[model samples]
Target: MNSHHQIIKTSPASLFLFCLLILPLSATCNVEKTVVARCIDQERDALLKFKHHIQSDECGLMDLWGNPGTPDCCTWKGVSCSNPSGHVIGLNLSAAPYQKTCLSISVFSPSLSELKFLKYLDLSSNYFYDMEIPSSIGSLVNLIHLNLSDSGFSGDIPHQLGNLSRLTSLDLSRNDELSAQSLNWLSQLTLLRDINLSGTDLSEATDWTQSIGSLSMLEVLQMDHCQLSTPLTSSSILYANLRIVSLSINYYINSSIFQWLFNNSNYSTVKQSLEYLDLSYNSFQGPIPNEIGNLKFLAYLNLSRNSFSRTVPDAMGNMEFLKYLDLSYNSLSSTIPDEIGNLQSLMYMDLSYNSLSGSIPSTLRFSGALETMHSLSYLDLSHNRLEGFAPGDVEDSHSTSHINSSNQLEGPIPSSVGGSSPLLHLDISYNLLQGSIPSAIGDLHSIVHIDLSYNHLQGPIPSSLGGASSISYLDFSNNYLEGAIPISIANLKYLGYLDLSNNYLRGDIPCKLEITKTPYFAKFTYNNLSGSIPIKLSYLGYNAFEGNPNFHMDKFQGRCDDDKHDGNIYLGLYVSIGLGFYTGFWVFCGTLTLKNSWRHAYFRFLDRIIDKIYVVVAVYLARFRRKSQV
Candidate 1:
């Protein structure tokens, strides 16, 4: 047996040295843990005081703010603290669902200044009730993001906000009562990357453009509804880094602003850097200048709701990267340039409510013949002067979804519309379109809404339409359509709205089992339909079945016995009655089955009732026989 036992033990001096080396490290770890886990007591008390000043907490934010069990305010909702510093850095109590009662404050809370480390503070969408923006907000000099938009703060905007030298984003929009006499404060925010002052009154701020121009790092500026109708001088500087600019709804009539934005010679910076531009709902008139195409990087362009008249510039085709283009609600005339198909990345293009005339470009069609602009998903040229037939031979339009061109176009709808595209909505109402609706339209598995009313179309409603299980709204009213209403319409599980009034349709109203159980709207008035109207559809009221003399409308007379029937009252009554009968029958049977005493009592009661009925019958029989003998 070769046993080797080498037991070496540490000395007292060595153990003491090891303890000396590990104790300080353990203490440091505890110190760091305390710092990271707990928020400062001063900041927490300040937050509580702020909450106390709020007259309304309808959003229930207070419930999560000061919980006794969780003393750490950092763990509370909408509070973010810094690491190792134990200081509150962010407080976002914005976008709460409460309406006017949200976090109401009559005065700005000075306690907010105690959060010296706050870098982000958002009190947007709250109700402040026309209080002046306090200068104390500037004390939070470390703030990089501040949003007080849509909060009822009136009076002059405090210039002290400019003291936040580190601020990169500032939003003071939707406070219609707020005004700025001078934009000198804005000039001091040199590091600002985004600023939104929409709905604020800045009519007196003549130096608005000059102040904003000074910010070399400014990238996004939105000053819509700011009463900025005054024209900018040609010498006004443009931002080289500006990517997005929205100045809509100010009724700006200055063509000079356009000169400053698109002039290739003087303002080459904005011409090259601007990517998203929105100048809609303004009074800027005259033809859209060809210089707009200078911005090759522009992706979204919205020049709608303006007084701009004349043909759309062909230069628009030069912006190959344009994804969203809306020129609706203008006085634009002339045929749509075929060059629009050059935008390969275009997704949505709307030119409705204009005076544009001529046939729709083949490039915009769902037909696969010219596979131009394959990525287009939505195209709406409705309420225009366009004429001629709609595009046909649609077999490869895999992305076109919405087509609402209610113009003078007259022709048969393409039959292969349902081939590959997942069309979601189709509305060609109030047009001169003739011929029957294509049956292939029913094959669109993703179709949601379809409207083809007020046309000269004539034919029987397609039976295959019931296959569109996702369709929620269908309208074929005021048309020449005839023949029986398809019974297959009952298969639509999601059909919520149906209107086939004023048509020559003649048939029995189909009973939709599921529709009767749920809420739905249907109108079949002025039709030749002759049959007993579905009792369930009576919930839609008498007007829905009026004007059809052949229809047995007596079934709906006195149905609800009151005018309250207009609001689904009768349908609710039927459902309640059905549920009550079902529930009551099961309850009675269950009670008898579950309790032996109840079961015996029920049978005994039945026996006595039967004996009484038998005696009555015997007496009646003897009386009848005696009368016969007499």
Candidate 2:
């Protein structure tokens, strides 16, 4: 206000300097913006092409990258771009998440080629059938990962795929009648680390062997359900460097190849580096060679559900590093050797469903180390004839008891067994057992499943079992157990399946039957249980109470005509009675026939005599009438 100093302050030189300072940054930002816009437009075009390739009833133009209510192909599900500046780098227009069956490959958008910079592609689990793979797929040079699994793709793999030099992973599994005609080209993609060809039902060209031989640097290869008719190993180059491999569930598959591969007879320089192997559900037979001991690095092995039979090789126990071993459902026989105890690192071992007989090896006792072998979380010895000393059966009673009532083995439930084993599942059913459930079982709180059915077990169910909080499945049926059903069983909250039937036990249903955590979970059924059916048991299926004759249902009525059980017993009873009486009744009628044969000549004589007598009586009556009239 002192001197109205409103002089104009214009600095032309400073303005020019500022503009020069900001020019480079603005140009870089503008460059990025232009690149992003161009990429987005190309992505949209690519999506449109993809939509065109998809069949009707599959995604259409309206639901694809198009505007709402229209078949705009860009705004579709599973469409992604790399960065603002990247082309449509990902496209996942798969049909797995949908259950509709309409599938036509011609509906796929041809504009997908516009995504020239695409790096990832997934068209897995689409309900497509015999759709011709676009030869243009090879043009996606920037693709790093591609998955077309379970798309019902057929025909030969396109050699054009070799053009994807940057690919690191490719999965074309679960196709029908697809052969690896161009798999050799994939070997050239040195960056590829994983390849899955499972369930492809590949042809018998034997080209697959040559193709995989070249992938020296591959880390993981899965060929399960590939319909490879030959043994798995047909290697031209040694897979000594291979890490992870799976070739399971193939018909006519074999471990003979593995046996040959691991042996020095074929490739002396080869030393197997495999850590995991699965040769299950095959017909491989013969002895497990001793050289298998050389696979010291092996941690997991599965030879289950196969036809292999013989004594388990002692060499198996030599691999002290084993964590998992499954030889179940096989024909393996002979006593398990004590050498098994060498696998102190073992966590899981299943020898169930085998023909192995003889005493359970003391090695399983682990010298009272059973409680500390935490890694051994699951052990199944079911459905086998394993005989052994009952827990605490050793000579010295003062010594620490080894065999505990951990299992319901026959002879007797050694009360001491419950003191040692905290086993999760103990099933010793269908054996020549003669014993009562030991009360000591109440001490094993960690138990979850118990099956002592089909044995000679007797005695009341110990009240201690009610404290088994984690129990879920308990079966003591087909035994001699007696006494009233214990009420303590009500404390089992986690119980989902309980079968105490086919025994002599009689009692009123425990009131807690209504208090199951799951209302209709399961019930005490098929037992000698009487005193009215538990009302809550109405929730169970009708078949659940089949063997319990006294059980009744208030609403039960006759079943439909087709129901097999409909009046079947009554009808069978009538037929049996009729058949049983027919022979005797017919034999009595034969007696009458013999009577006629014995005195057949007197029939007319008896008739004559009877006529004479009748005539005399008539004459007398006539005379008497005449006299009365006179």
Candidate 3:
């Protein structure tokens, strides 16, 4: 009876331990089975059907689809599936590293629409040939992103695309044959935030701007090169949330669009949100409105290749966040405002090809306590009439500087130039700058191109210039620089274009300057250089050495032998001709004197020729007289 009692107690403890382990194990198995069942069989079959329709899989990405050994379709390349449900939601076939694997589907496949839960589809940069976008794509109501850019699609965009009301981004750019006869369908998609229709024909879509403005949530609108000519109505309400707008390469005739965009009463939200505005390559005329300063968030503004005139507005300095400002290729006049120094974040400023006249502002030098505009890297003021000294203290390291053509900048080049900044390109040609070039110029070790031509710079060519090992183009032509050509110039291995012409440089051309594999362009014309030309430099043509009176061509005979031999050949021909003429004349005279029959035959032939000429002249004179009488 005591042993039975012990067994009952042990049995109860064992049963408790069994329930603790085996019951939880059974629940865990059921959970795993439920997770595996979430990957629906129907969705896997649909993905397999879609892969079979891909006419070309050059990248071999479709090999994983529908393999029974790997039953999960969620692990396929360029595909994404929802977490637990395991439904296909995204398919991206953008041609990136494997551009050769571009799809070339001749006909649009309806199998893709089978993925009912798909929200993102990208097939950009492929070779779909001349097939139209499939009308059946509208069946995907859950799609929020669709990109078919540069896919070689032709014909009209389907109106059925208006069904995708949830789409936030749509890019159909760079399909040259793509056309949109009407954009009335775009109004249905209110959730669109970005739209890029560049290189598509929208000439007939006169209400394109209005249609786009209706989407109040739109942030980016790019319609470049669309052959658009219609002007935006002054009273039209533009999208308030727009941050980027590119309308370049169009033919809108009116400048009033600017007033409508910036000066409109309803554009307060747009002015604050707009960041990038590109209106380049248009026919815009008249003064740029001062009201543009209201856009406090404007960072990039490009108005180049237009007809904007008058002074640059002083109010532009109020845009403290402006990073890139390009106003080139315009007829703008007047002085660059000192207020320009207020832009603390300005990085690139190009005001070239204008009629602006006056001295460069001292504030632009960045030398004073103002301490703004320090980020300036690229500054081009070429082809203008600005005068006075070059900004001496303007120090931006590795800056590309251009002040060439018709400027009256004078005085010596600043010694501080190479001390602070390693210049990339420094061109100050066609200016009135005088005084010797600073020897410190060699400190710009990163200098690539240097042009100080058409100036009054005098004194010895700096030997220190050879320290600039990266110099590719160096021009000091039309100056008064004298002394021997610097021997240190031979150290420039990267010198591709070297011009010291119209100067007073002397001495023999350096043999080290001769590059055989890729010959350097060298011009030393009208200089005082002497001695024999280098044999390798002879290929540069004789004009390179012309006007150098002391240069001896005969000393470099190995290279000039062909030219000398050709001259000798002409001399021999002349002598032979003269000797032949003398011999023939004497032979004829002797024959006439010794043989009377030969002389008479020659005289008879000459007489016949003279008689024919007289008869022809008489007939022409008679015809002229008869016509005059009539």
Candidate 4:
């Protein structure tokens, strides 16, 4: 009974030891199984076959596949395998790093479909020539992300792609020859979140909007330059949950497309979720719909390069989140709305190349408060017919302002321009602006380009302008600007383009002007500049110094005639020569006509000279004749 009790107690301890040992042993077996679970033999063979079709691999991307010792394809460059199953789940042979490698293949092999477990595939930025995407790719039903963008693929997008129900992102953009005959297959990919078909042909897919709209979870749809002519239907439901929709450069000529897109049943949803909407480079005409403001979440709006006529919608102020607004290259007319000043979050605003008229709204000017577009860094209202005083208090420190061309703005440039704001580029050229360039302009230490050309701006260029050390381009041409070129201008180490032509500028060019550092485009033509040009500036052509009568060009040709009295001397010499000629002609001719003896003597002298010439000619002819006889 004692032995039995002892054995039973020891049994429990022995069993515990046995359990620890067996557990370690089982773990070792599992480790061995994982080691042996390398890439499947069939899948490895498929990869090798696929590599064989690669006509060229400058990056040597396929060197590891079937390489002497490296038999496992999971260890290859762009292959990923599952941890336990060891199935190839990802193949990313994107040519982003090997820019020089032209990875061409005559045919996309069906063997790629052998990677049945593949969930991610990216062959972007590779040159596949004109090979069509194989329909066998549909065999990868587990694929969640497939990107073949800019891969040189052509032909029809296989309808079989719809089989990837789990696909979340599909990017086949920048394939100019790729086409989608029908998008009905896309209706199957209900979980797809993003689709980028930019630069593809979708003109024939008349039901694209309807088919794409059915993807209720779609977040981003980029189809720029897709040849899509069909307008969005009123029933299109694609706007829901769509954060970005880039359909620019399409063939939608009618303006009603906006009405359909913004007035749809899903407008309310789009207003809340939509962030980026690009309909630029199209033929959109008529006024921009006031309903555009309904997209409260919109951040970036680009309607440039269209024929959008009439005033910009005042309702745009409602988009409080709007940061970038570009309405350039359109025919938008009427006064810029004061509502534009309400966009406090606006950073970049471009309304150039339009017929917008009337004075610039005072609200656009800085008020030393945050209620204005205080965040605005770039403001371009160029190439318009706007007339008004220059906005005096534009206090955005880092702003670049351009209000060029045909603006009838009159008055001195706002003195606060360079003094208060850290203005970088200020171009108010090609206008009727009159007044002296404010001396305060020199305070713009950060100014890079300042163009006040082609205006009636008069008065001496402020010596303060030279204080702007960052000035690279300075154009004050075709104006009535007078006075000597400021010596301080020579301090501009970055001065690349300097034009002061067609001005009343006098005095010699600043000797300190670093001609060698001057840009090739430097022009000082058609000015009242006098005195010899500096030898350092002699290399410049005469055209640069033309119309400056007092300026000497002979010095450039190695002559130093700096005679201050040369002009008066030449004038006196010309007068004397004229008088002498007049006296000699009259005296000789009158004396010969009035005195018969003098006339007869003159005739005899002329006859004698004629006879002597005839005799000399006759003698030479006779001598030549005699020589010929000999």
Candidate 5:
């Protein structure tokens, strides 16, 4: 009986061991099940649904999915972020639909609505056949930005967008359906900071000022290129908060109307915050207001391509922060104010194509910021009546040149112009300044382009000129600058254009000279230059020297014999261009064999070819000359 009891107790021990082993396994299984319940089947479900939709679509979503349409729409062109879960916030599906056989709009991926946290939705740069915006966009309230611009949507914008209040920046530029009326729902949005409705036909905008003006926090309102019938002048206070404003290429062509409309808006306090203002290509006239200087914060002001008249205001000096000042293409007259130089931050300045006449200011120190600009290029003061050396001391290191007329303004250039600033471009043509060319002029190291034509600068040409190694373009034509062509000009490695026509400059051209790489054009016409046409000048035609009255050419086989060559030298230039190309090609080929490789094979080959060619040419030339003598 005791033995039987022991056996039953041992059997229970085996059963207990089995139950303990299964307990941990059960716990693990349970935990795994819980994780599965929590994890969303985002990828599998979304892709599966996308594939099914592409496989069968009644809304013709297959067109956007493209021909031989993929079963999985997410795999189509321009489609990104196929995950249905909120993990994907950016989706750029554009220009996917191209169905010539089935030209119809379709919602290819209805599962896109499954993405709850999409922040950026760009369907632009596409020919998507979407005539109406997908209504599911309202479901993605987590969106901070939504762009369906240029997606072929032609219907009115839905009011469902009023739900997107988190937007700080919005762009609907280049949309045909986006009009002022469709965007009128944006009046109540408080978080909006930027909005672009450019290229939209908003001419039918009703109560636009009352609607758009209420966006108090809006800093950039780009309704540029819009056809708005309503004048924004009524909401000057609304637009005053803007730091950058561009109304360029609009229909406000009436100067009086534009100014009056601009004045209707508060130009006083609002103008102060404006940093960059572009009113180019508009109809703006009258003297710029004295209040314009109130924009102390304004740094860049472009009033070019306009009809603005009267003298520039002295108050402009108050804008110490002003940097880029472009007043080109205007009728501004009178001498530039010495105070104009007070803009300490001034860097790029373009006063080209204006009617300003005067001596340059002396104290025009520029902004320190100019030193840091990587592309701070172009300072054009051409086509104006600015005479003498632009003010300031020629001794100043920054000055390109100094024109010291001594108030006895002569028709000849003064010698003191050598003291002016060393600008990249110096155009003092079409003036009455006259004097002998100063040797100090050669000291201008920063001079790259000089147009001293149509003046009375005379005396022997300085050979030291163009030794700076930076002169690229030099035109001394229509002047009394005489004497032989400066041999020192050969030092100009970067010279691309040389115009010396109508000058008293003489002498034969030098033998060893370099006139830039290709794409070079040089002129010495109407000069007293008497010498054989340089065989090296096979590339350049004659128009560059039309005015040289006493220029003569040596008898050469290559020189054009016809007097017609003198009347219009550029006549057969196009036909002769093939010669330039032919020579350039051969030279490039010869250099290619030697560059970097330093190949001994190439060297030997070239030496043999060159020697053979030289010998042959010499023999041919001697024979030809003997025949001529005979």
Candidate 6:
């Protein structure tokens, strides 16, 4: 530095730009240390002869093949090679963890069509006991994703898989004895985009919608329980990128297949790439159409158990990215449409066993009055025939957790019922609901199933409902509820199913419910509860302390009788043995049919007596002779 060393110099254009950037980064670190290619020894001996015709590798994936130094079948375990053309494209043997693997379609081998660049094949939930998906897998033909679902494949599906033609996602769902007679060889696969013949058997295909309408690159058409009762004609197969249309448990009673799947002038790109529309348990009846609000990007709309009747359509609140709306077990009557609260991205709304009557729609936070579905979570209007007055205006809906408005609703439960829930299942059972039992529903500390049973609900039972503390199923049965049973619901540590039956509830029974030991269902029967019973609940005998007539139980003494003394001793012992067998069977057949001399002196009685005497003498003599012979 002291000598003014300014003679720095490199030649030929800075040594040719430093050897052209270190010779392509030293040839990309020697091509990134190469190795990721060793698969093809004829596709690793055709996957070791398909794992030596595995008779059952319960998915131990053929013991991960020769792992001593990793004899690389593209590093095994669901092999997928082809870095530098090692070529065994992909073979994911799905069914690990939880599906509990069971591989054995003889390990699906027809020498795996020698992996001619196999393109993704997942043998899902393996156990092909009914085998036959192998028409040599239509010679692979570079398959593009084919998952044989729930494995256990069965016969007839092979029209040589329409010779692959670059299949794009074809899951033969569930398998249930496969079938699919003539889907006209699926119109030669025109690059199908997701076609799951769920629980296949396509009822002899009937050219299955003209071979899925010649799949104009269809998008997810799951034919659930494919006994598909055809009936959607006029096709040009315009599935301009259709998105998830599941004809669940098929028998689509032509609602014109919803105008041929919302055909806004010949399937307007399936209502803008329809998103998850399932015609559940199909026998689809009429009236879901307000043109289904033009499907504006629908998100999971299931017409449950279909027989869809009128009225749910206020143009389905224009969808607004609706999330899971199921018109349950349909017979869909009127009134639920407060435009379904304009679906602020609604989350799970089910009109249960429909006949949906009025009330509960204050902007649809169902009974929470009006939080306007701040992402409502599971609201089921149970067994509907609904009447009014549920709105006590609970405050904070915090994404409601299951509120089932059990039908025939009447007044009074609204004392800020759990203040708008963090609720976990609260069903207003068979309602005519009267008062008292809502100590804010114990402020629903994550309540767990609370059903105000057969209501005409009276007082007591709410020691703040044991502050919920994650209550586990508590029902106030046939409510006319009275006092006592609340020792904070016997200190609830996850109390399991407790029903205060035929309530007029009296005292005792709670002995801290024997210190909260996960009560596997305890019902205080005909409550007027007195004492005795809880010697650790005496193994819930005497039908959980029968009609409490001073409820005793040194092990159910005197068997707790009183529903009018066991219905008057079983109605006077079935009416005194049915009136003493109807008066000795009509007085011995009315004196032998109105006495024809007492029916010929009870007939043969006389003849029989005489014969008996004679026979007796003869038998005595015979017996003596036989004894002697013996």
Per-prediction TM-score, please? Answer: 0.78, 0.68, 0.78, 0.79, 0.64, 0.36
Candidate 1 whole-model C-alpha lDDT, 0 to 1 = 0.82
Greater lDDT among 4 and 5 belongs to 4
Deviation from native of the Cα of residue 227 in model 1, angstroms: 2.3
TM-score of 5: 0.64
Output the lDDT of residue 531, model 4: 76
- Each model's RMSD to truth, in Å? 13.0, 22.7, 22.6, 18.9, 17.6, 25.7
Candidate 3 local lDDT, residue 363: 59
What ranges in model 1 sit over 4 Å off? 1-45, 59-76, 96-102, 264-266, 368-370, 399-401, 513-520, 555-630
Instruction: Name the regions of candidate 5 deviating beyond 4 angstroms.
Output: 1-86, 91-114, 122-140, 146-163, 174-182, 235-240, 253-272, 358-381, 386-392, 395-422, 542-630
Q: Write the per-residue lDDT of candidate 4 for residues 430-521, one digit (tens) a residue.
A: 88888899888898888888999989999999998888988888899999999999878888878778889999999888755654345556
lDDT of 1 at 349: 90
Give Cα distance to truth, residue 256, candidate 1, Å: 2.6
Q: Positional deviation of 360 in candidate 2, in angstroms?
A: 1.9
- lDDT of all predictions: 0.82, 0.66, 0.80, 0.82, 0.62, 0.76
Off by over 4 Å in 3: 1-71, 97-101, 365-370, 394-398, 403-406, 514-520, 535-543, 553-630
lDDT of 6 by residue, 517-601 (tens): 4647787888777877765567666776678888776543233333347788888999999999999999999989988987897
Error of 5 at 445 (Å): 3.7
- Select the stronger candidate by TM-score from 2 and 4: 4
